[model samples]
Target: MFDAQYSENVSHPLRVVPLSQLARAGGLGLGAERSYMAPVLFWIAHGQGRLSVGGALRGYTGHNAIFLPANLSHGIEISPRCQGTAVFFAEKSMLPFPPTELHLRMQGVQVQSEMNQLIEELRLESLSDSPDRDLMLFHRAALMLLWLNRQSGKPHVPSVQVSDMLRAIAQPKR
Candidate 1:
């Protein structure tokens, strides 16, 4: 099921929300078919569900990461017990996200923990009011892109390395 609603605000470069919140919102904002002007990433840490992307239906379970590119129709049916986070990225950002969709079944505890940490960092950066909050968010978001690209086996140009260098330089010396 998909919703025809298309009024999502893209002013925020990124957003992270629990899957339960979306499920509670109904219209299958958790299940209904919907499309956004920006890309979306779904990280399923627990439970199982059905997802439809670009008109193809597939089943997804825990430790899964799904990426849907902008303007493509998608909808998900996550179980009540599903524990997950949805990451939305503004279409206007300069981040180097892959042009195609990805449904990654992440394996290994190390890789899973790495993805979780990166998301936690993004969530924290988003709540800060620091003068360089935007820059920090961009850097963190770029790291996420780098992680995704690497995990997906896609060739990447390493822009996040520059962000890492900038962060090192910004840190106060011990």
Candidate 2:
């Protein structure tokens, strides 16, 4: 069942998925887990839920941000009232950056506030029919991810020759 109110957009190299405005059902249970070819940054707001990633289970409440590395199997058990935004970035987006070991770590500073603001802005931009909204939201998403990566002490893995090779092998032609 598709809701007319919820709109989804795929902006070239990235996918911006807003999970709000969907009708709330009963508690969501675990099912077949899947992984992504590109890194996925998810922000959960206004929900009490549990997520299982790479065999580890973590609980989240209120507002929380999580990063799932590419090709890592993960599943979410969303509460009936769950609402959030999920942003997917192609490997190209991480290019010219350092590796996750040196760039993707999270800082102790609470960045949820800023992240929430970005999510709201993205939601608005996604819903709007303006031509520039997609471009604006795309840049905002990149900035948010960079901020989070910088704070976490993770090195920005640049997509150099070697990095590109790795990405290529990680994503073979379909």
Estimated TM-score for each candidate:
0.83, 0.60
The whole-model C-alpha lDDT of candidate 1 against the native structure comes to 0.81
The model with the greatest lDDT is 1
> Could you give the C-alpha RMSD of every candidate to the true structure, in order shown?
4.8, 9.7
**Count: clashes, candidate 1:** 6
Per-residue lDDT of model 2, residues 1-174, tens digit only: 111122333223555675453224322244646566666766776676777776777676666677776656766676657777676665445332223312122223466667777777766766677888757766776666666676666645654786888788999698
Q: What is the lDDT of residue 152 in candidate 2?
A: 67
Task: State, as a TM-score between 0 and 1, how close model 2 is to the true structure.
Answer: 0.60
Scanning candidate 1 in windows of ten residues, the lowest lDDT window is 1-10
Assess each prediction's global lDDT (C-alpha) against the native.
0.81, 0.59
